[model samples]
Target chain A: MEPTNERHLLEALASGDRRAAERLVDETYRQVFASLVRLTGGDTEAAADLTQETYRKAWKSLPSFRRRSQLTTWLYRIAYNTFLNSIRRPVLLQPIDEQQAVAIEDPDPDQAAKLQQRDVAERLRRAVIGLPEPLRFTISARFWGELAVEEIARQEQVTGAAIRKRLKLATSRLREALGEDAI
Target chain B: MTQPTDREVKSLLTEVEIPEPPADLAARIKSEIPADLSSGRFEGTDLEVFDAPRRSPSRGWLIAASLVVAVGGGLIALRQMDQFQTPAGALESGVVASEAAASDAVAPESVQYRSPVDQSLDDAELETVLVEEIQLNEPLETRSSMEAKPDDSRLQEKSTPGPDVTSADKVVVDEVTAGQAELDEVSADRDRSDRTRVDQKTVASQDLPSPATRKVERSEPAPSRGPQPKLETPSEQPQPEAPGEQQTRARQRADSTGAFEKRQAAQPPQAPATVESTAVAAPAPVRESARLEDGAADRSFAGARAGSALAGSALADSALAGSVLAGSYQQVRSALSEGRWPAPEAIRRAEIVLGFGFGGPEAESKQESASPADRFTILVDELVEILERRQATESELEHLLRRSRALATELDGQPAVEELVVWIEQIGALVESAEER
Candidate 1:
């Protein structure tokens, strides 16, 4: 929802409002779970556990929320940290620290194009998760939050140009890491 | 295909399917938050646990006061017991006799090591303390040995035996017993060889075993008497002290015997004399033997103290020789509990100093040490410290950890020392990075 509505929910929960607490969890659980599943590389159980943990941490830290940023961004930061602590090490998306170069050979042009696109998409997902923390956060917020570049910049207290630059750098890393797979 | 343009990557990201959460997810979350604030359980949405209010100075003061009160109360109780002991000595002795009869007495081994009973405490009081300490923290074998003054029927049953010892205890007991047996066998071998040599001298004064005869004997492969894998009855190495009582007893014995004083006194007077003698003349082999003997004695004391430290009794801690057996297992347990490991530097130093790779995989080198228990303890402490630091590339530390774990497991069932095993596994996880290797 809107930043104003989120702020209202935050206020309500902080003031001992049980209905508001339920509403907050209800609205955020799906998004948090979806975000976690992507971050965890589609491990459903880990996604669920991390989701619950994120919410539990969010609920506890709600009272301390000073509304310096959007409530969603605040919750995402908590989710990110919870994820990091649980994983204990950086998540290695590629097998054996070796990225698989896309190998394409097909007689049909259409079939080859389709296969290449599929490979590129898979590589992109892996790259997004594998991106350095700052860029990963920006990409996640932009895609999952569906927030505009300006909104992300505003929330992060950076200029719109910086957000664009981060997005550019992240895409380049993905291309480099994916190689020919980045079709 | 050429590298994908950023547009293609962006387009792909936009189309990427974000899995829909389970339907019950919202319901599950909602259920966690209480329906009403009246219960005061879910009054606030946030967790106060992690963000607990800062400790006020008052709390610190309160803790200090409580400690002081506890110490004072203990002193008062001790004094009162002392007062009562003198007037009711006869009655207390009668009570002690009855109490000993009520429970199965400790094994005869314990009787040999039992300390002089404090005149301040009655039999009942002493029993209460020993019983409480043993029951609370002593190992199973220790409790069994301490409490079970076996009835004649039970003794007879044990004599007839069907694995009277738990499998875990059986391995440890077997190991210690085998070690003793091996030492005895080696001594006997030397004695037999000496006797044959003497007899030969009498028979033929100049007819020594010739170079060919000696060569033949050397060529004959001796049968390997590796640590006897035989699981003997636990009766062979009787349980002496509970783990918790051992430490207390060790401290008491150290105080009584002025062990610390002896250690201090031993060094100073001999130090200047040894330096002067060694500098002026070549140090004799006798001095080396004396040094080795002293080292062995120190190890024996350390082992004994280690055993008693866990048993929580003075009775178990005084066994200078037996402690050597008890100390190895005790140190393992202590190392596990405390997460104590030797420093990385210490391990490296040992390797360099000893001239063999001390921290290498257990199978690689077979450098014999005068004190294997001390070496084992050092290795365990080092491995633990390394794992706790969570750097997986220390392959040497990893090997030591695995070896120690295997040693512990071989001596006991996995479940018997489950806690230590679990902790070790955690260390393994911490050290084993997501590196594909």
Candidate 2:
């Protein structure tokens, strides 16, 4: 959303305008849901719950929104944190390991290539999840959440240089973990 | 197999598949949301209009029940009165009996006649009949007092008995007049006391310092403890110091300790006994002021000690302005985690302080002192450097931890500080786990 329009909507939401909240949900829920889907490794149900949880949190925190970062970036940060907190719970459903499943017979080369891509994506997801503390968050937010380096830095309350450095370190770690050819 | 380049890896990350959200997801979420988003009430904001409490049917039923009981009691009493009034001769006899009972407690039981009609009456009816008889036989003075209004004109009329009035009526009038006089005296005394209290309050208010004067006093720097300067009389001293003069004096006092030490070391030391004797010889007001300054210093020292202790705990130090920024960060994180908004004031304070660093070179130049953002950045960088090296000594880690804790304490346990603390611990844990491996 445009910053001005977002600000106006935020003002309306802060004043308890229901229409503004509905409009916010309409504009952002898809992107938010998609980010959660990637973070949860294709668990659509958990992603949907987390998406709703993010909006609920966003609505509650609307009054304190300072327009420091773009509203979407702010929402993404909330979505990211929600994902982190959910993972901390003991009963969280583990992502299904598709690699170990019985292979289906494929006659076409395109079909086999698609399967290879899915495998690569799954491996990358696992490697990202395995990355420590802030690197995991940083890489996930940048790649999955699709947030800009500046936006992540603003959300993290750090310098742009620090965020870029983190991204570099996270990428190098991913490279090392996946074995360079895995990608 | 060929290794993927950084560009290819980045492209692959971007291409990771995301499932489409369910069609009913948005509708489901919105349905649960209240129509009025303003229901998420904020503290110190005049946005919410709360509805008045509704009256309950239970309270209404209680009132109705009370009315029914009272009306029923009244009807029963009235019925008893009607039975008593059936015969005038019987009523007269009852009043005489009641007067005898009241005036002569030792009246003979044989003299109290219980007729067949009276025997038919229950205990409640008999009691009601006796009460009515006593009210009829009461002295005129008692009845007059009970019926009289507080109006002065009515009391005067009652006091002036008519020519046909008996001696008993005259006695009643005199008693009523005496009672009215006592009430008037008490009301006058109350008025006097009220006026005296108000006057005392006015004087006390006048004696209190003005707001501006109190502000000045609060802003004033602590006095020095070196050799006492010669005291100045009210006439000799300037009436009121200018803002510049106040600032200069404060600055001088702040720098005085270093200057005093330098002077002491350069020159021969004076006898402590002589200095004490000179200080004691000072004027009473000057000595008192010095004593107050000493007390102020002691109190400030004690407060600092208390503040440090408080900062060491989980609770944030609200007195530190830097902590407000930290609080704002927490407010955002907590809002996400706990599903509540941050206070507007916390966000505003964070914005203002952050604007100093993030507002570009112009803002940095405008601010003469180091902004909280700068301090926060510096602390984060230092902590990160130590964590990255993973070769820090125990003492080094402790010192960094203390600095991190102090900053967090200033920010009031901002999640960033908590995150830093977590990172430090995680590094330690990783080292332990590696050793085990």
Candidate 3:
């Protein structure tokens, strides 16, 4: 994703270079897949298929891409749209209950002490799945995709300030749902 | 109300584990790249697998064009049929007049009379020789002439004008009348055959006398070889119908047959043998009168030939009229050559060739002023000139031949012009037979 390499790849892709398309796919497919898996609530198979589709769409739309943002950002935009389109039903978040919030906040000392009560990672996964779309997407791309805030803003077609405010709101909601003890 | 620090949230979000993507995912996507690019770099699922082949737009257009052509052709044929209808009687008369005109054109000169041959020999020998010659050279004519007596008996029943005959006789008469009507229906077709038979009879009669006289005259002793006597010896008598007696009977028989033939000419042109056989028995006078009728038949036939030739020329001259279709000419030629010429078919063909079809634009422009015979003469003269010029195409010549064929058909059953019909047919046969060569 260096400025020089991206510019060269973008130009080569615009000129219909297959190698550049392959190179772009290779550089971005993993991050896109990982982000989609989390975005799709642990649906790894669907996430993998959507990841391939995203690359294909990117290859076709590459010629029209102006390169105003990073290639990865453009790719993530395609991946997000691709996953959203492929899913048959709405991927809405369920409402959090007060007792579930209390379990994350002050885990019952007995429950916490139980030998094989669900681990912190499992609870965190459940908490992330319950987040709404776009907030879910933003949080996943930032943490799982490891994309910069500014990069996420560019990929999502939003201002950097709006992304930051969304990130703040998403974090507060997750905290309320999971409780301080879980963090 | 303060939000958690970005570092704290980022740290917590990092704890959220995401499952690893399949290792072969990118490899699978790459494998599909060539197929996608091959189909113009299409993205997403292949929809063509689900779709059936669509009908070509051009196929629909071709079907529409064929329908249009079929409908258009049907309309044109219907329109043509409407324009072509005509009453049959006027057409028949016009055709008859044209054929008679043609016969007159063929034999313009009247037959010349010659002095009677010498009468020195045996009557039995002369009759035997003439009969034998007729049987050999003019079998059909001889047959017809021989059959004429029975036919006459049959005709008597039909034309008897009395109810005294039995009911069965009346039925036979009715049948004969019906048959005659049928034959009349194709009068034009019979003319060529009748013409040929008449010509053969004329030749047989004239030539038969020659051999008989030659044999007898050669045997006689010379009387100083000076101018021979017109009279034969008294003991070497011919028939008891000596000069006036036999001549009158022969004349009367020939006259009846000849007049009967002339009347029948408007009917169908029956076989000439019927007429020829009746003349088989008569003495020199009967033979002489047969020769006179033959001469008359020849002149009529010659005129018909001239008419046919004229028709050919007229057709060539009016080739640009487009009024004469090849189909009509083919029908006329078929009728002429097919052994029977229906008067209706002959008239139809004649009008088409002569540009006289009802309401035809060409006929309107080229009014038919000359008599059919004179017009036929003009046509023959024109065709002769064209043939001499060597400027006409085979199609032009064929058109001429077809015109002659149509005229020949028109001339059928016309006993007066039987000779001309024969002549025109000879020309047609000559021209057509040349193709084999």
Specify the highest-DockQ model's number: 2
Misplaced by over 4 Å in model 1 are A89-122, A180-183, B34-437
Winner of 1 and 2 under DockQ: 2
TM-score (chain A only) for the predictions, listed in order = 0.74, 0.84, 0.69
Worst 10 residues of 3 chain B by lDDT: B355-364
Count of residue pairs whose backbone atoms collide, per candidate: 27, 2, 29
lDDT of 1 by residue, B142-259 (tens): 3223323333342333222222223333443343344444333333343343344334323431333333343343232221111112212222323211211121222222222212
Ranking by DockQ: 2, 1, 3
Per-model C-alpha RMSD:
30.8, 40.7, 26.6
Could you give the candidate ranking by TM-score, starting with the highest? 2, 1, 3
Per-residue lDDT of A1-183 in model 1, one digit per residue for the tens?
677888788677767788988788877777778767666656666778777767766665665676777766777777767776766644522233323333533467668766766566656766777788889888877875466787778778899999999988988887777774534
> In candidate 3, how many Å is residue B21 off?
3.3
What DockQ does candidate 3 score? 0.15
Q: How close is candidate 1 to the true structure, as a TM-score?
A: 0.33
Give the alpha carbon lDDT tens digit for every residue of B1-437 in model 2: 45555776688788967778899999876764555566653332212222236789999999999999999999988975664343323333343444334223322111111212222233344334422322122222222343233333433332323333344344434544554443333333333433443343234334333333433332332211122223222123333122112222211221211122222233344322222221111111122322332233233234334443322221111112223322443443333232223344434322222211111111134344444334455555564454335455656656665675565445443323434443343334344444557
Evaluate residue B78 in candidate 3 and report its C-alpha lDDT on the 0 to 100 scale.
83
Q: What share of the true interface contacts does each candidate keep?
A: 0.41, 0.45, 0.32
Over 4 Å off in model 2, which ranges?
Answer: A90-92, A95-110, A180-183, B1-3, B35-437
lDDT leader: 2
Q: Which TM-score value belongs to model 2? A: 0.34
